[model samples]
Target: MSTANESATANPTVLHFSADNDIADIYRAHLPPGWSLDALSAAPDEAEKLRKVRRADALFLTETPLTRDHLAVAERLRLIQRQGVGYDTVDLDAVRARGIPLAICPHGTPTAVAEHAILLMLAAGRHIVRLHEDITVHGRWPKWDYRSRTLGLDGATIGIVGFGRIGQEVARRLLAFGSDVLVYRAPGRPPLERSWPRDRVRTCPTLNDLFAAVDIVTLHCPLTPENRGFVNRTLLERMKPEAILVNTARGALVNEDDLVAALRERCLAGAGLDTLTVEPPPADHPLFSLPNVVLTPHMAAGTRQAHIIKAQAMFENVRRVWNGEEPLHRVV
Candidate 1:
């Protein structure tokens, strides 16, 4: 990936905060001929630099939270293309008030994230992390007491909070394990896609019902103001005592403080998380102290293949916006 700043062209300027230079290079290559690309640092101190160069025609945004103040400075900016699926960090209201279309590369994330969610589920169910630490770090051998704590996926009922692309993919894999799948979709939405055998999967009427009935519950829903902290004390309380929780979606979807309390009280068996409310959370984050929780940095969609696919979709949308055509995955 070339880092040298290319000469400006006659075409419109597309500004991006180069958090991942390799992905940035992919974006640059896919852009239409004559389009010019400019890079900015994703750090807060560099935001002023972004404001000074406010003539960008479009933005390829990463995880940096774009506030109303930031948008106010970019007077000519017309589109915001997110490289990944989650948009909770970007201020949608500000974008909509400006009439700038906001889009995401949803086509690129499902498979990798779904696979990660399953990995978390299996690891939590089997206590993989704790067992590895027990043997390698403490030099303890496997014993019958440790074996009694582990749970198997087979014959267990699994509940998926949101039946989107990733959730459906998870259901497909769980079925192969001989697990019963239950799904809950937001109100007024259509039924699960017909391709997934309807008889093999059942739909729950409400989140409460789903939580109470399943042996494991996984969240794949996007985080929004209305649904922020959707997995709270009340929902966690409703879950079966032996049930495990897995989250591969946005971290804010589960209230961290509440989750900590649940683990402390053993209200739930365990949790497997690939994201948290804050990235690189404080060194003393409570989740770190719990033996029953397995945490991974937010890398569910970080696979090489997913990156290529996401970059392609992101630039394709950018090309459409540049051509004054409707974007393929408009979210706002």
Candidate 2:
């Protein structure tokens, strides 16, 4: 038998997976030079996909949902390696049922994601993306849009909705612009002003305080059942009419319908969203019609550096599994 078969029959280990094109390349680069990787552009039909995955010891995924059925067929599967922080795409309960450890990149993508959030904030504040599209795509060169808008970052207050790693990094970048920074984090997890320049940024006493006081509110929190619709009508109503909104964190955190209504009523000045309530929001989604809303296809961690870090993180976890060591970044 061939070495692959010998290994599969003897150790039952193979790295099986799917990931975005760029992420997949990074994964490949992190592996040994001669190692081969199997990839599926899209998960094929069940029997076929299972046949392709049957001998695998681990699976790596990004974006594609890994349900119970997907895991059930991989009899030798020992680990599930996720490319980034969020494991929502991988069903934890299913992994538990099969006794497979799930791993994610622990120190992965936060810096890149944080940078992306700051970029979104600036883009939204200044209508940067919209203006660029007008100049390049619509041939509106040599001038600005008749209804164009802009917000000066200097002397403005930026409210961070979550003060996690990415949120703190966003705060770090905001400091360069001399903007006043206010943060709203879970109780007992207040902002650490010492970690950042104390002269400019300050911590808010409450979430409402941050919402009421800032010129721009950027979301950096995760999506959970309790906070899924956190940015609904009530919260949107609390913002200053001219306050801009930015979310690079996750989609479900905001109530899309309420946001659309707020935009329609002109309650919000504009928004920059790298994520949406659903990935690739339907073409007819109401948010698309708003001239002030800037939407990206969740490309915040799209940089090459971020991709390499993610790949390394996944490989580290795979190595741990191969050696019978506990996987890092276990989600469930």
Model 1, global lDDT: 0.82
Give the Cα error of residue 235 in candidate 2, in Å: 1.0
Measured against the true structure, the TM-scores of the candidates, in listed sequence, are: 0.88, 0.88
Please identify model 2 stretches exceeding 4 Å from their true place. 1-16, 133-149, 188-193
Candidate 1 segments exceeding 4 Å error: 1-9, 18-20, 25-35, 42-55, 143-145
Summing lDDT over every window of 10 consecutive residues in candidate 1, give the lowest-scoring window: 1-10
Per-residue lDDT value at 164 in model 2: 78
Cα lDDT tens digits for candidate 1, 86-183 = 78778778888878888888866898998899899989989999889989999997766567668788999999989888888889889998889999
- Per-residue lDDT over 1-332 for candidate 2, one digit per residue giving the tens place of the 0 to 100 score: 11223332344344445633655666666775444566665546666567656767677776767888878777767778777777878777878887887777746578888888777777777777767888889888635543346686788899998887788788877888778888788778744857576767677887777877889999988778888988888888888888899999889998999999998898889899999877877889998898889888898977888877776776667666666678887876
Q: How accurate locally is residue 105 in candidate 2, as Cα lDDT from 0 to 100?
A: 71
With a 3 Å backbone cut-off (N, CA, C), the pairs that clash in candidate 2 are: none
Q: Cα deviation of 110 in candidate 2 (Å)?
A: 1.4
Tell me each candidate's RMSD, in Å, in order: 4.3, 3.6
